[model samples]
Target: MALRACGFIIFRRLPPENIEFLLLQTSYGEHHWTPPKGHVDPGEDDLTTALRETQEEAGLGLEQLSVVDGFLQTLRYEVRGRSKDVLYWLAELRDPHTTVTLSPEHTAFRWAGLDQACALVQYSDIQETLREAHHFVLKRNE
Candidate 1:
Protein backbone atom coordinates (compact mmCIF):
# COMPACT_ATOMS: atom_id res chain seq x y z
CA MET A 1 0.00 0.00 0.00
CA ALA A 2 1.13 3.53 -0.77
CA LEU A 3 2.04 5.69 2.20
CA ARG A 4 -0.43 8.54 2.60
CA ALA A 5 0.15 12.03 3.96
CA CYS A 6 -1.83 15.26 3.86
CA GLY A 7 -1.22 18.96 4.45
CA PHE A 8 -2.13 22.53 3.57
CA ILE A 9 -0.35 24.65 1.02
CA ILE A 10 -0.43 27.55 3.42
CA PHE A 11 -0.25 31.06 2.00
CA ARG A 12 -0.55 34.58 3.32
CA ARG A 13 -1.54 37.64 1.36
CA LEU A 14 0.41 40.84 1.61
CA PRO A 15 -0.53 44.37 0.80
CA PRO A 16 -0.82 45.44 -2.85
CA GLU A 17 -1.68 41.90 -4.02
CA ASN A 18 1.38 39.93 -2.98
CA ILE A 19 1.13 36.38 -1.73
CA GLU A 20 3.67 34.26 0.09
CA PHE A 21 3.65 30.55 0.85
CA LEU A 22 5.09 28.83 3.90
CA LEU A 23 7.80 26.18 3.72
CA LEU A 24 9.38 24.27 6.56
CA GLN A 25 12.88 22.82 6.54
CA THR A 26 13.12 19.29 7.86
CA SER A 27 15.44 18.35 10.70
CA TYR A 28 16.28 15.00 9.14
CA GLY A 29 17.28 13.42 5.85
CA GLU A 30 18.43 15.88 3.17
CA HIS A 31 16.67 18.62 5.14
CA HIS A 32 14.41 19.33 2.22
CA TRP A 33 11.93 22.16 2.52
CA THR A 34 8.22 21.39 2.30
CA PRO A 35 4.83 22.51 3.47
CA PRO A 36 3.91 21.30 6.92
CA LYS A 37 2.65 17.72 6.56
CA GLY A 38 2.86 14.26 8.00
CA HIS A 39 1.77 10.62 7.77
CA VAL A 40 -1.85 9.80 8.37
CA ASP A 41 -2.39 8.03 11.63
CA PRO A 42 -4.46 4.87 11.74
CA GLY A 43 -8.20 5.60 12.04
CA GLU A 44 -7.68 9.30 11.24
CA ASP A 45 -9.17 10.91 8.17
CA ASP A 46 -6.98 12.81 5.73
CA LEU A 47 -8.22 16.31 6.59
CA THR A 48 -7.84 15.66 10.27
CA THR A 49 -4.33 14.46 9.71
CA ALA A 50 -3.54 17.58 7.73
CA LEU A 51 -4.91 19.83 10.43
CA ARG A 52 -3.26 17.94 13.24
CA GLU A 53 0.08 17.85 11.52
CA THR A 54 -0.04 21.53 10.70
CA GLN A 55 -0.74 22.34 14.32
CA GLU A 56 1.89 19.96 15.62
CA GLU A 57 4.57 20.93 13.13
CA ALA A 58 3.93 24.59 12.44
CA GLY A 59 1.93 25.64 15.47
CA LEU A 60 -0.87 26.85 13.26
CA GLY A 61 -4.35 25.94 14.33
CA LEU A 62 -7.50 25.70 12.24
CA GLU A 63 -8.65 29.03 13.63
CA GLN A 64 -5.62 30.69 12.10
CA LEU A 65 -6.48 29.57 8.58
CA SER A 66 -9.20 30.04 6.06
CA VAL A 67 -9.44 26.82 4.11
CA VAL A 68 -9.74 27.44 0.42
CA ASP A 69 -12.68 25.90 -1.35
CA GLY A 70 -12.33 24.00 -4.64
CA PHE A 71 -8.58 23.62 -4.50
CA LEU A 72 -6.89 20.29 -3.79
CA GLN A 73 -3.83 18.63 -5.27
CA THR A 74 -2.47 15.14 -4.96
CA LEU A 75 1.06 14.04 -5.75
CA ARG A 76 2.30 10.49 -6.07
CA TYR A 77 5.98 9.83 -5.60
CA GLU A 78 8.48 7.30 -4.28
CA VAL A 79 10.27 7.53 -0.95
CA ARG A 80 12.97 5.04 0.03
CA GLY A 81 11.71 2.67 -2.65
CA ARG A 82 8.12 2.81 -1.46
CA SER A 83 5.21 4.51 -3.19
CA LYS A 84 3.80 7.55 -1.41
CA ASP A 85 0.78 9.73 -2.02
CA VAL A 86 0.31 13.21 -0.57
CA LEU A 87 -2.78 15.37 -0.56
CA TYR A 88 -2.50 19.14 -0.28
CA TRP A 89 -5.32 21.53 0.42
CA LEU A 90 -4.85 25.26 -0.04
CA ALA A 91 -5.35 27.52 2.98
CA GLU A 92 -4.89 31.23 3.49
CA LEU A 93 -3.51 32.37 6.78
CA ARG A 94 -6.13 34.47 8.50
CA ASP A 95 -3.53 36.98 9.57
CA PRO A 96 -0.45 37.58 7.49
CA HIS A 97 1.52 38.66 10.55
CA THR A 98 0.73 35.65 12.70
CA THR A 99 3.80 34.26 14.44
CA VAL A 100 5.03 30.85 13.32
CA THR A 101 6.23 28.51 16.03
CA LEU A 102 8.21 25.57 14.76
CA SER A 103 8.44 22.13 16.27
CA PRO A 104 11.46 19.86 16.50
CA GLU A 105 10.44 18.18 13.25
CA HIS A 106 11.48 21.34 11.42
CA THR A 107 14.72 23.21 11.82
CA ALA A 108 13.53 26.45 10.22
CA PHE A 109 10.69 28.06 8.32
CA ARG A 110 10.34 30.49 5.46
CA TRP A 111 7.64 32.53 3.77
CA ALA A 112 8.38 32.82 0.09
CA GLY A 113 6.77 33.89 -3.13
CA LEU A 114 5.99 31.47 -5.96
CA ASP A 115 9.37 31.41 -7.63
CA GLN A 116 11.26 31.18 -4.36
CA ALA A 117 8.92 28.54 -3.01
CA CYS A 118 9.40 26.43 -6.12
CA ALA A 119 13.13 26.78 -5.78
CA LEU A 120 13.15 25.87 -2.10
CA VAL A 121 11.41 22.56 -2.57
CA GLN A 122 13.56 20.04 -4.44
CA TYR A 123 10.69 18.01 -5.93
CA SER A 124 9.33 18.89 -9.33
CA ASP A 125 5.86 17.81 -8.36
CA ILE A 126 5.87 20.11 -5.32
CA GLN A 127 7.10 23.01 -7.40
CA GLU A 128 4.32 22.43 -9.90
CA THR A 129 1.85 22.12 -7.06
CA LEU A 130 2.94 25.54 -5.76
CA ARG A 131 2.45 27.04 -9.20
CA GLU A 132 -1.00 25.57 -9.50
CA ALA A 133 -1.93 26.84 -6.07
CA HIS A 134 -0.73 30.36 -6.80
CA HIS A 135 -2.73 30.46 -10.00
CA PHE A 136 -5.76 29.08 -8.23
CA VAL A 137 -5.64 31.82 -5.61
CA LEU A 138 -5.20 34.54 -8.21
CA LYS A 139 -8.06 33.26 -10.30
CA ARG A 140 -10.37 32.75 -7.38
CA ASN A 141 -9.86 36.30 -6.14
CA GLU A 142 -10.58 37.79 -9.55
Candidate 2:
Protein backbone atom coordinates (compact mmCIF):
# COMPACT_ATOMS: atom_id res chain seq x y z
CA MET A 1 0.00 0.00 0.00
CA ALA A 2 1.09 3.53 -0.73
CA LEU A 3 1.98 5.70 2.23
CA ARG A 4 -0.52 8.52 2.48
CA ALA A 5 0.04 12.03 3.74
CA CYS A 6 -1.84 15.30 3.74
CA GLY A 7 -0.99 18.95 4.16
CA PHE A 8 -1.97 22.50 3.31
CA ILE A 9 -0.51 24.76 0.71
CA ILE A 10 -0.66 27.71 3.03
CA PHE A 11 -0.21 31.24 1.80
CA ARG A 12 -0.94 34.83 2.70
CA ARG A 13 -1.46 37.98 0.73
CA LEU A 14 0.37 41.17 1.61
CA PRO A 15 -0.75 44.66 0.73
CA PRO A 16 -1.57 45.34 -2.91
CA GLU A 17 -1.59 41.60 -3.64
CA ASN A 18 1.82 40.22 -2.82
CA ILE A 19 1.27 36.57 -2.01
CA GLU A 20 3.71 34.43 -0.06
CA PHE A 21 3.67 30.70 0.64
CA LEU A 22 4.63 28.90 3.84
CA LEU A 23 7.43 26.35 3.81
CA LEU A 24 9.02 24.54 6.73
CA GLN A 25 12.57 23.25 6.92
CA THR A 26 12.82 19.73 8.26
CA SER A 27 15.38 19.10 10.96
CA TYR A 28 16.37 15.63 9.83
CA GLY A 29 18.01 14.01 6.84
CA GLU A 30 18.72 16.37 3.96
CA HIS A 31 17.11 19.26 5.87
CA HIS A 32 14.80 19.92 2.95
CA TRP A 33 12.05 22.49 2.99
CA THR A 34 8.45 21.52 2.42
CA PRO A 35 4.98 22.40 3.52
CA PRO A 36 3.67 21.41 6.94
CA LYS A 37 2.69 17.79 6.38
CA GLY A 38 2.65 14.39 7.99
CA HIS A 39 1.51 10.83 7.60
CA VAL A 40 -2.17 10.14 8.11
CA ASP A 41 -3.19 8.17 11.13
CA PRO A 42 -5.50 5.24 10.80
CA GLY A 43 -9.20 6.17 10.53
CA GLU A 44 -8.35 9.82 9.88
CA ASP A 45 -9.45 11.58 6.73
CA ASP A 46 -7.24 13.60 4.45
CA LEU A 47 -8.41 17.11 5.35
CA THR A 48 -8.31 16.31 9.03
CA THR A 49 -4.73 15.14 8.68
CA ALA A 50 -3.91 18.34 6.86
CA LEU A 51 -5.33 20.51 9.59
CA ARG A 52 -3.84 18.46 12.39
CA GLU A 53 -0.41 18.39 10.82
CA THR A 54 -0.56 22.12 10.17
CA GLN A 55 -1.28 22.74 13.80
CA GLU A 56 1.35 20.32 15.08
CA GLU A 57 4.02 21.40 12.65
CA ALA A 58 3.37 25.14 12.26
CA GLY A 59 1.17 25.97 15.21
CA LEU A 60 -1.55 27.19 12.88
CA GLY A 61 -5.03 26.14 13.82
CA LEU A 62 -8.13 25.89 11.72
CA GLU A 63 -9.24 29.29 13.01
CA GLN A 64 -6.21 30.93 11.47
CA LEU A 65 -6.96 30.10 7.87
CA SER A 66 -9.66 30.30 5.25
CA VAL A 67 -9.67 27.06 3.37
CA VAL A 68 -9.78 27.62 -0.38
CA ASP A 69 -12.15 25.75 -2.65
CA GLY A 70 -11.39 24.04 -5.91
CA PHE A 71 -7.72 23.77 -5.06
CA LEU A 72 -6.85 20.26 -3.95
CA GLN A 73 -3.83 18.61 -5.53
CA THR A 74 -2.33 15.17 -5.14
CA LEU A 75 1.17 14.06 -5.96
CA ARG A 76 2.47 10.50 -6.15
CA TYR A 77 6.10 9.73 -5.77
CA GLU A 78 8.55 7.10 -4.61
CA VAL A 79 10.40 7.25 -1.31
CA ARG A 80 12.89 4.56 -0.40
CA GLY A 81 11.46 2.31 -3.11
CA ARG A 82 7.96 2.64 -1.72
CA SER A 83 5.05 4.46 -3.28
CA LYS A 84 3.84 7.54 -1.52
CA ASP A 85 0.84 9.76 -2.11
CA VAL A 86 0.43 13.24 -0.74
CA LEU A 87 -2.65 15.40 -0.81
CA TYR A 88 -2.40 19.15 -0.45
CA TRP A 89 -5.28 21.41 0.34
CA LEU A 90 -5.03 25.12 -0.25
CA ALA A 91 -5.68 27.71 2.43
CA GLU A 92 -5.20 31.43 2.88
CA LEU A 93 -3.77 32.65 6.15
CA ARG A 94 -6.28 34.96 7.79
CA ASP A 95 -3.57 37.40 8.75
CA PRO A 96 -0.57 38.17 6.64
CA HIS A 97 1.57 38.90 9.65
CA THR A 98 0.52 36.05 11.91
CA THR A 99 3.25 34.47 13.99
CA VAL A 100 4.55 30.99 13.11
CA THR A 101 5.74 28.65 15.83
CA LEU A 102 7.63 25.59 14.73
CA SER A 103 7.68 22.11 16.18
CA PRO A 104 10.80 20.07 16.86
CA GLU A 105 10.54 18.43 13.47
CA HIS A 106 11.16 21.72 11.75
CA THR A 107 14.09 24.01 12.40
CA ALA A 108 12.87 27.02 10.43
CA PHE A 109 9.98 28.42 8.48
CA ARG A 110 9.55 30.97 5.74
CA TRP A 111 6.72 32.70 3.95
CA ALA A 112 8.07 32.93 0.44
CA GLY A 113 6.69 34.35 -2.72
CA LEU A 114 6.28 32.11 -5.75
CA ASP A 115 9.82 32.19 -7.07
CA GLN A 116 11.37 31.73 -3.67
CA ALA A 117 8.95 28.99 -2.67
CA CYS A 118 9.52 27.10 -5.86
CA ALA A 119 13.24 27.47 -5.43
CA LEU A 120 13.08 26.26 -1.86
CA VAL A 121 11.03 23.16 -2.57
CA GLN A 122 12.98 22.31 -5.76
CA TYR A 123 10.56 19.59 -6.85
CA SER A 124 8.65 19.88 -10.08
CA ASP A 125 5.42 18.57 -8.59
CA ILE A 126 5.48 20.90 -5.59
CA GLN A 127 6.42 23.87 -7.76
CA GLU A 128 3.49 23.07 -10.02
CA THR A 129 1.19 22.81 -7.02
CA LEU A 130 2.27 26.25 -5.84
CA ARG A 131 1.61 27.65 -9.26
CA GLU A 132 -1.81 26.09 -9.25
CA ALA A 133 -2.63 27.46 -5.84
CA HIS A 134 -1.53 30.97 -6.85
CA HIS A 135 -3.53 30.80 -10.03
CA PHE A 136 -6.57 29.54 -8.17
CA VAL A 137 -6.46 32.37 -5.66
CA LEU A 138 -5.95 35.01 -8.31
CA LYS A 139 -8.75 33.67 -10.44
CA ARG A 140 -11.07 33.21 -7.50
CA ASN A 141 -10.69 36.79 -6.39
CA GLU A 142 -10.96 38.26 -9.84
Candidate 3:
Protein backbone atom coordinates (compact mmCIF):
# COMPACT_ATOMS: atom_id res chain seq x y z
CA MET A 1 0.00 0.00 0.00
CA ALA A 2 1.23 3.50 -0.90
CA LEU A 3 1.18 6.13 1.81
CA ARG A 4 -0.21 9.47 0.66
CA ALA A 5 0.71 12.87 2.09
CA CYS A 6 0.02 16.49 1.16
CA GLY A 7 1.57 19.86 1.99
CA PHE A 8 2.27 23.40 0.81
CA ILE A 9 5.38 24.96 -0.63
CA ILE A 10 4.77 28.09 1.35
CA PHE A 11 6.74 31.22 0.53
CA ARG A 12 6.92 34.82 1.62
CA ARG A 13 8.12 37.93 -0.13
CA LEU A 14 10.51 40.15 1.81
CA PRO A 15 10.01 43.28 -0.27
CA PRO A 16 12.84 44.65 -2.44
CA GLU A 17 15.15 41.91 -1.29
CA ASN A 18 14.17 38.23 -1.67
CA ILE A 19 11.63 35.52 -1.10
CA GLU A 20 11.84 33.00 1.69
CA PHE A 21 10.45 29.49 2.02
CA LEU A 22 9.17 27.91 5.16
CA LEU A 23 10.65 24.61 6.34
CA LEU A 24 10.06 22.59 9.43
CA GLN A 25 12.37 20.05 11.05
CA THR A 26 10.46 16.95 11.92
CA SER A 27 10.92 15.46 15.37
CA TYR A 28 10.55 11.92 14.11
CA GLY A 29 12.23 9.78 11.49
CA GLU A 30 15.63 11.14 10.46
CA HIS A 31 14.61 14.59 11.65
CA HIS A 32 14.34 15.65 8.06
CA TRP A 33 13.38 19.13 7.08
CA THR A 34 10.24 19.46 4.97
CA PRO A 35 7.36 21.75 4.32
CA PRO A 36 4.39 21.10 6.54
CA LYS A 37 2.99 17.73 5.50
CA GLY A 38 1.23 14.74 6.96
CA HIS A 39 -0.62 11.61 5.90
CA VAL A 40 -3.93 12.28 4.25
CA ASP A 41 -6.73 11.58 6.66
CA PRO A 42 -9.82 9.56 5.72
CA GLY A 43 -12.48 11.48 3.79
CA GLU A 44 -10.13 14.39 3.07
CA ASP A 45 -9.36 15.50 -0.44
CA ASP A 46 -5.81 16.34 -1.42
CA LEU A 47 -6.28 20.09 -1.09
CA THR A 48 -8.05 19.65 2.20
CA THR A 49 -5.23 17.47 3.40
CA ALA A 50 -2.74 20.13 2.45
CA LEU A 51 -4.65 22.84 4.25
CA ARG A 52 -5.28 20.74 7.32
CA GLU A 53 -1.69 19.59 7.61
CA THR A 54 -0.39 23.12 7.15
CA GLN A 55 -2.64 24.39 9.88
CA GLU A 56 -1.91 21.48 12.17
CA GLU A 57 1.84 21.53 11.71
CA ALA A 58 2.66 25.19 11.11
CA GLY A 59 -0.30 26.95 12.62
CA LEU A 60 -1.05 28.64 9.34
CA GLY A 61 -4.63 28.71 8.17
CA LEU A 62 -6.27 29.20 4.79
CA GLU A 63 -6.89 32.80 5.72
CA GLN A 64 -3.17 33.50 6.02
CA LEU A 65 -2.24 32.10 2.64
CA SER A 66 -2.88 32.91 -0.98
CA VAL A 67 -2.91 29.69 -2.97
CA VAL A 68 -0.88 29.91 -6.12
CA ASP A 69 -2.46 28.22 -9.10
CA GLY A 70 -0.83 25.76 -11.51
CA PHE A 71 2.02 24.60 -9.30
CA LEU A 72 2.07 21.06 -7.90
CA GLN A 73 4.80 18.53 -7.14
CA THR A 74 4.67 14.83 -6.46
CA LEU A 75 7.57 13.02 -4.86
CA ARG A 76 7.95 9.31 -4.32
CA TYR A 77 10.30 7.66 -1.87
CA GLU A 78 10.73 4.62 0.33
CA VAL A 79 9.97 4.81 4.01
CA ARG A 80 10.68 1.65 5.99
CA GLY A 81 10.85 -0.15 2.61
CA ARG A 82 7.33 0.96 1.72
CA SER A 83 6.65 3.39 -1.07
CA LYS A 84 5.22 6.74 -0.06
CA ASP A 85 3.98 9.58 -2.25
CA VAL A 86 3.82 13.20 -1.17
CA LEU A 87 2.05 15.95 -3.07
CA TYR A 88 2.77 19.63 -2.54
CA TRP A 89 0.98 22.73 -3.70
CA LEU A 90 2.45 26.22 -3.83
CA ALA A 91 1.18 29.10 -1.72
CA GLU A 92 2.27 32.55 -0.58
CA LEU A 93 1.86 33.90 2.87
CA ARG A 94 -0.31 37.00 2.76
CA ASP A 95 1.84 38.65 5.38
CA PRO A 96 5.54 37.96 5.66
CA HIS A 97 5.47 39.09 9.26
CA THR A 98 3.13 36.38 10.42
CA THR A 99 4.54 34.28 13.24
CA VAL A 100 4.76 30.51 12.97
CA THR A 101 3.53 28.29 15.78
CA LEU A 102 4.98 24.85 15.40
CA SER A 103 3.40 21.70 16.72
CA PRO A 104 5.21 19.12 18.82
CA GLU A 105 5.73 17.08 15.69
CA HIS A 106 8.47 19.48 14.65
CA THR A 107 11.53 20.59 16.57
CA ALA A 108 12.12 23.87 14.72
CA PHE A 109 11.02 26.08 11.87
CA ARG A 110 12.84 28.46 9.58
CA TRP A 111 12.03 30.93 6.83
CA ALA A 112 15.03 30.98 4.55
CA GLY A 113 15.95 32.13 1.08
CA LEU A 114 16.50 29.64 -1.73
CA ASP A 115 20.07 28.65 -1.04
CA GLN A 116 19.58 28.53 2.70
CA ALA A 117 16.37 26.54 2.32
CA CYS A 118 18.00 24.03 0.01
CA ALA A 119 20.92 23.64 2.38
CA LEU A 120 18.67 23.10 5.36
CA VAL A 121 16.38 20.66 3.53
CA GLN A 122 19.38 18.50 2.49
CA TYR A 123 17.28 15.89 0.64
CA SER A 124 17.63 16.07 -3.12
CA ASP A 125 13.88 15.69 -3.68
CA ILE A 126 13.01 18.43 -1.21
CA GLN A 127 15.73 20.72 -2.52
CA GLU A 128 14.41 20.35 -6.05
CA THR A 129 10.89 20.93 -4.83
CA LEU A 130 11.92 24.21 -3.25
CA ARG A 131 13.78 25.26 -6.37
CA GLU A 132 10.75 24.49 -8.52
CA ALA A 133 8.44 26.38 -6.22
CA HIS A 134 10.77 29.38 -6.31
CA HIS A 135 10.79 29.36 -10.08
CA PHE A 136 7.05 28.91 -10.18
CA VAL A 137 6.53 32.13 -8.29
CA LEU A 138 9.14 33.99 -10.31
CA LYS A 139 7.53 32.80 -13.53
CA ARG A 140 4.12 33.88 -12.32
CA ASN A 141 5.44 37.31 -11.54
CA GLU A 142 7.10 37.69 -14.90
RMSD of each: 0.5, 0.6, 0.8
Per model, how many backbone clashes are there? Answer: 0, 0, 0
Please write out the lDDT profile of model 3 over residues 39-125, one tens digit for every residue.
999889999999999999999998999999899999999988899999999999999999999999999999999999999989899
What are the per-residue Cα lDDT tens digits for candidate 1 across 1-142? Answer: 9999999999999999899999999999999999999999999999999999999999998899999999989999999999999999999999999999999999999999999999999799999999999999999989
Error of 2 at 40 (Å): 0.4
Tell me the RMSD of model 2 versus the true structure.
0.6
- Lowest summed lDDT over 10 consecutive residues: which window, candidate 2? 62-71
Candidate 1 global TM-score = 0.99
Model 1 lDDT, full chain set: 0.96
Assess each prediction's global lDDT (C-alpha) against the native.
0.96, 0.95, 0.94
Report the backbone clash tally of model 3.
Answer: 0
> TM-score of model 2 relative to the true fold?
0.98
lDDT of 1 at 53: 97
- Could you give candidate 2's per-residue lDDT for residues 59-128 as a string of tens digits? 9988899998888899999999999999999998998889999999999999999999999998999999
Residue-level error in angstroms, candidate 3, position 9: 0.6
